[model samples]
Target: MRVLIIGAGGFVGRHLLPNLRDEGMEIIPTGRSPDRLRRLFPGCPVQQCDLSRDRAADWLPRLAGIDAVINLAGLIRDGAGGFDDVHEQGAKALFDACLAAGVRRVIQVSALGADEMGTSAYHRSKKAADDHLASLDPEGGRMDWAVLRPSLVIGRGGASTEMLAALAAAPLPLRLGPGDWRVQPLHVDDLVVIIIRLLHRREPFAGRLDLVGPEPMTTDTLTLTLRRWLGLPPARFLPLPRPLLALGAALGDRFGFGPASRDSLAMLAAGNVGDDSAVRAFLGRPARPLAQALARHPAMAADRWRARLLPLATPIRLLLAAIWIWTGIVSLGLYPVEGSYALLAPLGLTGLSATLALYGGALLDLGLGLALLLRWRPVAIGAAQLALMAVYTALISLYLPDLWLHPFGAISKNLAVAGATLAMMAMEAEHG
Candidate 1:
């Protein structure tokens, strides 16, 4: 059947579009950006449409002859679009157009709390749209209408998931309220199956349903899941009162960073877990556990495994660099330190310039340490570290008269740092 998918450019679009393909639905998708739509459904018919400004009613005629309409089109645009424009105005635009086009079925992708009157403007608007979509005419029957309200969808490759990954690995950690707040996170794939099921459900289930996972997880347990999935070190949380949380939201408004909105914080506090029976009943297969989902979702878990080792590698590099540089520094007539004979002599660059050699060694060691720990530039710092060490080893053997004593020791230390630097660079190359 010919199906039109709106907001098919978003995170939801990525999975939903592909699943629709599996269902053999002839897809016509629209998004705010054509480029994103192209990436979302390459080679499929994708057109640019914006509910924010463009007359969606105008596109109604364009979508003529479509059998079903999937309205995933909504706004989270910094509270600017508000529920008024998107949910109310946008819904009417699509509804009028769909009615004119004789589209029999429409499935709305809305959030869990859309029905609540006092919810954030965005949610209030979504609920209004849900109410409106439910009110559509029944043509031959109640225009096969189903609404899916999924809780936080956990998946790899989405913006929220990426941000979650960053939050998981951050040294400063996140400032969450009491860790008691709970949410049921649905894996995108599992949620996709439900959405796909709604497209052509023979069982005849309708109306608003909360699509959520099997278990409820607190913010603390969520963080712990992130730690395991992301493989980051321990978190450092700084507490802030509810008033300050509002202040943080205001600052985010000023700074354009879009941290947790007041509504989002309220969501965290309220512990939203959508109803599960319909989804559980429909899938027949139980929802995957959060941990298994964490392991399975590659976007969050693939590079995730590397973040765990970053902290350990950082300190080890720092210590090794220190020892390498320290050996060079203490060798300059300050003490009768004898380790690794002269590395440079034939070029006639030694004596106090030999002191410059120690300075060079210090720079390389410190630079490499920072690079590995992500405190410094990877390419420049690694190069500096390797270059300086190579020079120092060669100069030491060449200049010191005790060159034959332990020549290999001088080369070995420089070689060690160079090897480590190269290894790090190689892994980055491979991953990139």
Candidate 2:
């Protein structure tokens, strides 16, 4: 059977595509970026389409000759479109196109807690699309639709998993909320299996299915479990008050940094547990627990390193920034101007030339520092900082070699700073 996989470039879609292909199903992947899709699934037919922007008429051509459509498109935070646009309007449009094109089946991958009573905007928007799909006439049109509301989906390369792993790898993980916010993490592999079953089933199944793991675990237990999987010893957690978490969430909202946003916190507080009976009956077996699922694929050396280093990225970046900014401040006025001029004298710089060198170097240091702190073209800025450091070291060695052996080891400290800068750059590239 031919299947159209929407948002096929996502984390879950990446895992699902290969498995479906192995099952002998012809696949056509669609996403906003066709180039990326082609790169991901080489030689596979792909179409460029943005659900948020595309109407039913625009999606009609893509729907032609499609036997089934599986929509995996979703956004944790708003990007280019809001939740309502991507989740509700765009989804409704795609379902309409599916119906108009005589497509018989659709599987919507929605989040748990997506219902009329959903508090978070993410859940509420998802509910809107699920409702629209359920409202469609299945019996009259022979349309078979199933909505899969999965809880926290844990797997390799998943953003949430990566974030949680980083937290677990921290020297002292911060306990967010009251440590009672529970989540039933469904392995991405099981989720894939469930979808395959729904697709291959002969009988029509219309309505929502809460796909969750056999066990529901609290956030603290979840973190400790991840730590154990990573072969790390348990460490005491630093408790964060609700006010602090709220403040961090506000900052995250403003800066778009980590995963501490208001919506996410609210959803966590509400809890994400559900009955696993539906999944068990559908799969003919119980869903794998978190510990068992993680044990199946042991954490590799790279995974362990990634988790450990990811948390340090921000701190290293800030340290580099502080070094540059303070050095600039010292050069500008804090340090005696005469001493700077004296140092420049060794390079044949004097009077106006010496003054310009001092101030110019200070401004350059300040600029690099601010750029590093703000995270503007971070990789590029890091390269620039490295180059500048090299130049400074070379000039200092040629002119004032004695400073290298000074009591403070002024020139020697640059080696450590340079290493830290390189580490920061590597982490940024990996995370991005």
Candidate 3:
């Protein structure tokens, strides 16, 4: 079957085309940007025509041989005319063109809650188009349409990831007061499978359908999941007051960021949830778990690792270096381990400092070394080691009264962080 996917250069579209092509079906992909369309699907036919900007009259004739048209094109902006231009107007134009081209089987990629009241303009526009598609039928009355309504389509690419990475990379001290918002993220691969199935079914169309992942998680959990994938410190989400957020939204709008703040908060507030039983039954396979999905994503993981580990290298190196120096002095001047304890103990300075520098710092160094040489979990290992050392320092400072210089150890410890961290990275790179 020939499948014509509009907006075939977007996140979901980019993920979908390869699957369809692998199935050995010819695909005609359309997008707004000619370069993007060509870059995404070089072998498959690509047409550059913005559904909102260009009239369908010029492209409908070219869509002559299209059997099924999947519209993935949509706009995501708040206020004024962005939604109307892309979501509604663009979709309507594409549908009209598909109809003229005699493309009967249309699969509309709609969003959850689009048909519900109080939905955003983006949601409302999708709902309106969905309603229009459901109303159309041939004289014989074969419904000839199916809708794949996905909530929070999560993929390793595109705007959502860029946004998440940007937020994760911020340098300011973050403090969030109890993040409890629940959300679900669907894997683009799973959603694409459902879409492929929907495109071929000849049976009478049912009402709007929904596709979702198998798990639900809190916003805090989501942030942590992203952190683990990136090997970065967990995101510290501070709860901005609603009024402050509103002011931010206003500022963002003024600065031409659209209404990202308002819309994002609205989404976070409502929470994205849906029933997945319907599609799961059809797929005969459970949706990919968010954790598993992230683990399998190396590109996102690499990008995030670069963001997290690279900047902290200098400080970490300095700390590692300080730890070594302090340990070296304590072991050489004060604490002696190998020789007789009678001689070493009477020295009064105690070999504990020297022992810590040689042994404790070595353990720290080797642990850090292994962390860099291997690609297991560097941030996690670093955090654990830091905690342990901090506790050790606190205990010694309290009991011994003379060795309050432990904090200074961390100053030199960070020097080895880079080499060890890189070893781990190299291992991961080679295996991956």
Candidate 4:
């Protein structure tokens, strides 16, 4: 059967595509970036279509000869489009196009909290699309649709999984607020199995299914489990008050960093527990527990390295930025200009040349520092930082060799900073 998978470039979609292809299904994947999709799933027919930007008319052509549709499109945080556009309008348009094109089945992979009781905009917007799809009826009345509301899906390549694992691997793990917030974490692989079952089943199963794990777990328990999975020893967590977490969420909202936004905080407080009977019956077995699922695939060396190094990536970047920026500020008149020029004069720099070298080097330092801070072309910035450090160290060693033996180890510290920069670059490349 031919299937059209929307948002096929997302984490869940990436997993689902290969599984379906191995099951002998003709897959037509659609995402915002066709080039990326091609790179991700070679030899498969991929289409470039943005649900938020593309309308029903734009989607009609892609729906031709499609036997089934699975919409895994969602956003944790708004970008390029708000929640309403992506979750509501875009989804509605896709459903409409499906009906118009005579597609028989659609499975919407929505979130667990997306219901009438949902408080966050993320949930409410999802509910809107779910309602719209439920309300639609085609001329033949043969349309079969199921809304699968999955809890926190945990598996490799999942953003939430990576984030939680990194947090667990931190030297000092933090217990946010009371640490009582709970979730029924489902394995992404299990979710995929259910979708495949739904697609192949002869009997029509129409309605919503809350796909969740066998048991609910507290956030603390979840993190601890992840930590143990990484083969790390148990750690004492540093407790953080609700106010501090709230402040961090506020900062995350303002700066667009991390996953501590207000909406997520509210959702966490509400919790993500749900009945798993539907999932169990649908799959003909209980879903795998988080610990068991993780244990089945032992954490490889790369996994352990990722868990350990990810948390340190930001701090390393910040430290390097501060070093470069502070040095520039000190050189640009915060310290005596005469001293800077005196340091430069040993290399035959004098008069206007000395002044130019002093100020010009200071400006370059400031620019590199700001680039690191802003995360602009990190690989390039890292290379530049390394090269500049090498040049400075070589010049100092040749002209002012005594400074290397100074009590402060001022010249010696550059080696350590250069090493840090290389580490940061490796992390960036790993992420990309």
In order, how many clashes per candidate? 14, 0, 29, 0
Weakest ten-residue segment in model 3 by summed lDDT: 423-432
Full ranking by TM-score = 4, 2, 1, 3
Superposed model 3: Cα runs more than 4 Å off: 54-56, 138-143, 169-178, 202-206, 233-241, 258-261, 299-301, 305-432
Model 2 Cα lDDT, one tens digit per residue, 1-432: 999999999999999999999999999999999988998999899999987899999999998899899999987765445788898999999999988898989999999999877988889889999988988865525789999999999988787888788878888865767777899999998999999988898887798999899989999888888888888888998777888878977877776676667888788888999999988988899898888889988999888998887667788998999999999999999999889999999999999999999999999999999998998878889999999999999999999999999999899999999999999999787534
**Displacement of the residue 26 alpha carbon in candidate 4, Å:** 2.1
Residues 208-298 of candidate 4: C-alpha lDDT, one tens digit per residue: 8888999999989988988888888898987778898789778767755565677777888889999999988988889998899888778
What do the candidate models score in CA lDDT, each in turn?
0.66, 0.88, 0.64, 0.87
lDDT of 3 by residue, 296-335 (tens): 7754556765545533443454455454445545545455
- Those runs of model 4 whose alpha carbons end farther than 4 Å from true positions after fitting are 79-81, 138-140, 171-173
| TM-score per model over all chains | 0.66, 0.90, 0.65, 0.93
Candidate with the larger TM-score of 1 and 3: 1
Cα-lDDT of candidate 1: 0.66
In Å, residue 204's CA in model 3 sits off its true spot by 4.4
Full ranking by lDDT:
2, 4, 1, 3
Where does model 2 exceed 4 Å of error?
33-35, 79-81, 138-142, 172-174, 235-237, 351-356
What is the TM-score of candidate 1?
A: 0.66
